[model samples]
Target chain A: MRFGVVVFPGSNCDRDCYHVIKEVMEEPVEYIWHKEKSLSGFDALILPGGFSYGDYLRTGAIARFSPIMPAVMDFAQAGGLVLGICNGFQILLEAGLLPGAMLRNSSLKFICQPVFLKIQRNDTPFSNKFKSMQVVKIPIAHGEGNYYCDPRTLQEMKDNGQILFTYCSADGEETMEYNPNGSLANIAGIMNGKGNVLGMMPHPERYSEDILGGRDGFNIFASMINWLKGVG
Target chain B: MLKANIYVTLKNGVLDPQGEAVKKSLKILDFGQVNQVRIGKFIEVWLESRDQAAAIKELEEMSDKLLANPVIEDYRVEIVEVNQS
Candidate 1:
């Protein structure tokens, strides 16, 4: 399956995603610039992490208005797989492709460290490779990773199984202390109701290689690739 | 030209960590009367239209579409000045 990694202005993780798809995952991938309007040949899209448009106004706020976003939104609506990481997730939230919004990290600091994420579900295209309630170590670097949604929307997401991964202890316990960003319900990732679009604040590409200190994130890409290949 | 000043503030229920930090600092400075502090954005926009109603409508549309996220923010627009050259 061909993957397209979107490259927005100020996006620094596009190359990392490209490398993971090409070198690590052995998949055909291309970088799509933010000005490009067509997404005809891509089977999947990855909106990689970085401070797009310098995080001005708000994180991902200006980037959502980029020329390529409407096409990305259309691609997602057509049941195409779209994975948004970090600032990419913020863009998805701003574009209304996903529900909720991100707030400044509770500590008001840009946290860059590995944190434990509990796989809330293993049935979706993004997390199918993870065992049920599996805890994976992934690094998050951001100032606005605190996810927030109205109580009603949170309840609806909970009922619809939209929540995919959440911050937790290494032993897989969801507690306030383990909630690194003060995200509501410790949410670190979520999928839309249709399950075609997934957004998470952690950088899976950064840890997809064992040489990078951990390969716990490799399964996320593996899961997506397997699902696309009809193996899952 | 119409100069529009837009104020974007987080919704009442949403938490504001920056404002909370400022409040804490103020409390430490012995400013005991400050009960709450909420930080928001102030943006200035220049519009070519001179019609007040139309400019207000356009500014509202701009706020709804881009300037503020309705999910967590509430915005207000004021046509602060009208300039003619």
Candidate 2:
């Protein structure tokens, strides 16, 4: 599968994401500038994490207004697969492609460490490779990853199995202290209504190779490849 | 001309860590009576139309689509007529 990674100003993780997709996954990958308006040729898009627009105003706030966002919105609306990691997730929220908002970390500090995430729903294209309730280790580095939503929407997400992943301990056990950002219900990721768009705070691309850490995250992209193959 | 003031705030039940931090600072400074604080964003938008009704509708759409996250934020928009000499 061909992958297109969006490169915005202040995007620090674009290279890492590109390396993993091109080398580890053995998929053809290319960098797309944030100002470019067309995404017609790419099969999938990845918005990597970083301090986009220097996290000005708010994380992802200014980046949402970039010229490329209109095309990204159109891509996702047309059922194209889009994966947003870390600040990418925040940008998705700011762009209104995903629900909920990110707030400052409850601890009020930039947290950088390997975090465990429990897969809550594996039915979507993003997590179809994992079993429900399976735990995956990935690194999370951000200051505004706390997810907040109203009770009604939260209940709807729970009823619809939309909650994709939750923060957990390294051993896969759920714990309060391991909840790094104080995210409501320990939410680490979510999917859009159609399940084609995914926004997660953890960096799955960073851990896709065994050399960097583990290969658990490799399975996520692999699942996407398999899905594309099945469709094609 | 029309003037609109928008107040955006995190809805009740959602944690406001920034506001919490400021509240903690207030207590640290010996303001013991302060119990709670909530942080919000304010924006003033000026439009060329003098029609209050049209301006309110347009600003509301802007707020819903971009200015606020309805999932966690509540916004109030007030419209007023601007005087021109």
Candidate 3:
């Protein structure tokens, strides 16, 4: 699989995501600057986490208007896979590629730590490698990770199984203690209606290697690779 | 000239943690009358065109595309035209 990682002005995770896809997953990876308008050569896209545009005017607000969003939109519309992590998730929300909005953490502080996530749906392209309700450990670092959506849309997501992941205890139990940002329904990640676009607050790239503490996140990237291989 | 006032907020059912924190602070300050508080953003836009329909269309596009995330926030556009002497 040829993965393309989007690099914005303040994207700090571009290299980490590239390293994981290229080295860990052994897939071809390329960097596409935010100013670029085309994504013809890549099969999948990854919007890495970072403080894009310094997180001014709200997280992901400024970066949404970057030049490359049109191409991202096109790629998503074409049924190609796209993953947005952390601020990239916020940008996806701002860009309307995914539902819900990110708000200030319930604790009102920047949280940085390893978090446990429960796989809610394994049918989507992002989580097909895991079984339903499986637990994975990943790091989450953000100030605006609280996810919010309308009641109707929330119901719709639940009915359609669009929710892909949720915060959970290390043992895979759902509890308020595992809710780092107090996200509604303890949501940690979600997929678009078509299930091709995924936005999550956790840093999967940070955990792709065992030396980084764990290799649970590798399953997600590996799932993407398997999906691409199937398509090709 | 046409002006528009836009109010953006988190949709109902979504927790407003910031507003909750502010309400708690107000209570600690002895302002107990505050029953509930919801945080939102108010934006005023000025348009050079006097065509109300055109301005409204542009504003709607702006709101739908960038001014607000429709999934979580609903925006209302109110246009007021300045009377010329």
Candidate 4:
């Protein structure tokens, strides 16, 4: 599958994401500038991490209005796959493509470390490569990764099975101590109601290779690859 | 010209770690009588229009769509008129 990684000014992880897909995964990938107006030919879009727009005026507030967003929104609305990691997750929430909003880490500190994750669903393209309840280690680096939603939205997401991953122990136990940012319900990742778009705080691309001290994240990219092959 | 000064803050019931830290510092500085302390942002938006009502409406729209994330924040707008020197 062809992947397009959107690069906004101040996005530090665009190159990392591009390398993982192009060199490691052997998949076709291209850098999509923030000003580019089209997502016409890509099978999937990625909003990688970093302090976009220097995290000014809120983390994703300014980046949300970049020229490429309308195209990104159009693509996702048409059932196209969009995966937002880290600050990209912030942008997705700001753009209303995904539910909820991100808040400052409850501890009020920038956290950068590997944490265990419990996969909650495997039917979606983003997690199909993992078995239900599978545990994986991924790194999260951000100062404002806390996720918040109203009671109604939270209930709706729960009922719709939109939640995809939660911070958990190495043995797959979900608990408060494992939550790095005090995200509501230990939520580390979630997809849209339709399950086509996903926003997660953890950085999968950072841990997709053995050189990075972990390889569990490789399946996340593999899942999308297989999903595209099946549908395409 | 009409100026809209907006204050954005986390909504009630949401935890504010930064505010708590500031409150702790204030107490340590001998201000223990303080019952509460909450921190927020103040934004100034200047409008080049004579119609105060229109400016208020527009500022309200701006606050709702971009200035604040309703899920976690609440924003208030006030219109101030500035006199040119």
- Tell me the deviation in Å of residue B23 in model 4: 1.7
Per-residue lDDT tens digits for candidate 1, residues A60-119, read 999999999999999999999999999999999999999999999999999999999999
Per-model TM-score, in order, reads 0.99, 0.88, 0.88, 0.97
True contacts kept of each: 0.85, 0.85, 0.70, 0.65
Per-residue lDDT over B1-85 for candidate 4, one digit per residue giving the tens place of the 0 to 100 score: 7778999998998777788878888999999897677888899988888787888899999988888878779999988776553
TM-score, prediction 1: 0.99
Put down candidate 2 lDDT per residue, A51-143, tens digits, no spaces.
999987568888898889999999999988899999999999899888878988999999999889999877778887888889889889999
Candidates in descending lDDT order: 1, 4, 3, 2
Tens digit of per-residue lDDT, candidate 3, span B11-59: 7756777888899999999999997899888889998888888988999
Chain A TM-score for candidate 2 is 0.96
Give lDDT per model, in order: 0.95, 0.88, 0.89, 0.90
Q: Is candidate 2 or candidate 4 better by DockQ?
A: 4
- Runs in model 3 deviating more than 4 A are B1-5, B11-13, B50-57, B76-85
Hey, what RMSD does candidate 1 come out at? 0.8
What are the per-residue Cα lDDT tens digits for candidate 4 across A1-232?
A: 6999999999999998999999989999999999998777899999999999999988999999999999999999999899999999999999999889887898899999999999998888999989998998999899998888988899999999999999999999889988898899999999998899999999999989999899887888888888889951
Find the 10 residues in a row with the least total lDDT in model 4 chain A: A223-232
Model 2, span B1-85: residue lDDT tens:
7789999998887788889999999999999999999999999998988778888899999898777877778899998557674
Identify the superior model by DockQ, candidate 1 or candidate 4: 1
Error of 4 at A135 (Å): 1.1
Question: Could you give candidate 3's per-residue lDDT for residues A57-101 as a string of tens digits?
Answer: 578988999999999999999999999999899999888899878
